[model samples]
Target: MRLLHLGNVMMDLVLTVPALPERGGDVVATGSRSAPGGGFNVMAAAARQGLPVTYAGAHGSGPFGDRARAALREEGIDVLLAPRPERDTGFVVCLVDAEGERTFVTSPGAEATLRPTDLAQLRPEREDLVYLSGYGLLYEANRAALTAWVPQLDPAVTLIVDPGPLVRDIPADALQLLMARADWWSCNAREAALHTKIDDPAAAAGALRSRLKRGSALVRTGPDGCLLHHDGTLDVIPGFAVRPVDLNGAGDAHTGVFMAALAHGLAPAAAARRANAAAAMAVTVAGPATAPGADALDAFLRQSRPAPR
Candidate 1:
């Protein structure tokens, strides 16, 4: 199965501290690392899971772009970067605390310059799955292109949508339109609540499931676990307890693993379980794109005895 990930590919500079600092307070960072970001994290994780993955995005002609592409290549992800000579690659500065919570300061850079015409360059086969992140739809140009391209996609191609942390900024109608077109919808508890206007993650996920055209709704509830609504049933999957070093891209890892498992013919519940294990492993590392391979992930799953729903 070939997975096509569409969104920003960025260089992420992460600083890990023992604790998060208060407003206007100074703290020393204990660790620092650079990795990929946005949908690149997901694509890399999927590739690590042994999925055939292709990435579509814009990377500039700069040192950061070189690092980004190199990181992707190391993970064995096929890159389809837009050729832009004058722009610099996008990047973000992320601060992570001991508890794995993070704060991001971003510069869109070349990613912001992606135009509608770029969408025409993507030519995935009918069997490929397209995974789109919310950040891509946040910008007017990319959003317009996505809006125009979604309906034209081959019906055999599965579309998975992750609203990520930016769904609150999207118009309700646009959100609905994307939901209607998606084959699967995944979001964290906060994003799910914001999208459905429900404070409870499970209720919000259930509500969103009803609103979807032909897909299930999954809400990731941090350490408490995750809840999924599919085919008129709700399954509560427990999250594993791990000493997290960084939580920056855990969600992205989860989403990627879930999509990869699905592409490999796993049931939705089994895929969610696999993804949950992958995410548990991700938080144990320091970088945003630190996803475990299939062997490591399988061992983690074997040790994690998830609670029965």
Candidate 2:
């Protein structure tokens, strides 16, 4: 089964600062780098697990777009849409403080627009895993196109939704439409709280999972790990503790690895286990695209296993 990503991929300008400055204050960054971020992190994480991935999102024509396109190609992910002319891809200015937390300021570009014809070009096969992000719903064009197209998907195809940080901003009707067809829902603590109005991650997972017709819900709880609700059972998958260098893309890493593992036939609980490991590993690194490959993930899991009694 292939993984199809119908989300936005954009450029990320990351600046490492000692701490985020207060409003009207100034602070110089200690380091900086630019790379493909946003949905790119999820796709890249899945690709590293040997998943055959396709990016069916809009790209732009300028340097940022060019770089994002190149990065996708280099990662062996197929880009289905040609770059939109005269427009650059959108970008996020990521400010990372000493605690590994990041705040983003985004500028939407070509990636924000989606036409009806763009949706027509997608043809998901049986058992194919299709991913949609809350970011996609932030734009009227993309939101309309995706929500209208979702309910029409074949039963054989699986839909995964990750209602991101902007979950609260998405229209209720659109959010309901997407969730109605979602077969898997993966999100973090804040996002879960926003969607379910439950402050506890495990309880939030249970509430969300109850709404699914035939699917599961995963609520990632940072250092405490994740809660997976599947087949009427809720399992708390413990996290791997580590000193986080940067928390950017950690949730995406968990989502991508979880989907990839599920597509490869692992049980929901097992998939959550691997996803937890992937998230832990991602935060230990300092970059946004730090998802581990299969070999690295395997080795990390092996070493993290408990010793024999």
Query: How many clashing pairs per prediction, in order?
Result: 0, 0
Error of model 2, residue 71, in angstroms: 0.7
Count of backbone collisions in candidate 2: 0
Model 2 lDDT per residue over 1-309, tens place: 799999999999989899999999999999999999899999999999999999999999999998999999998999999899968999999888887787889999999988878989999999899999999999999998988888889988989999998899999999888777889988998899998999988899999998777778989888778888888888888888778887777998999999999999998889988988998999999787899999999999999952221
Local accuracy of candidate 1 as per-residue lDDT tens digits, 145-261: 788888788878889999978789886667888888888899999998888899988799989999998888889987666888988899998888888876767998899999899
What alpha-carbon RMSD in Å does predicted model 2 have with respect to the real structure? 2.1
Q: Predict model 2's lDDT versus the native.
A: 0.90
Could you tell me the TM-score of candidate 2? 0.94
lDDT score of residue 277 within candidate 2: 92
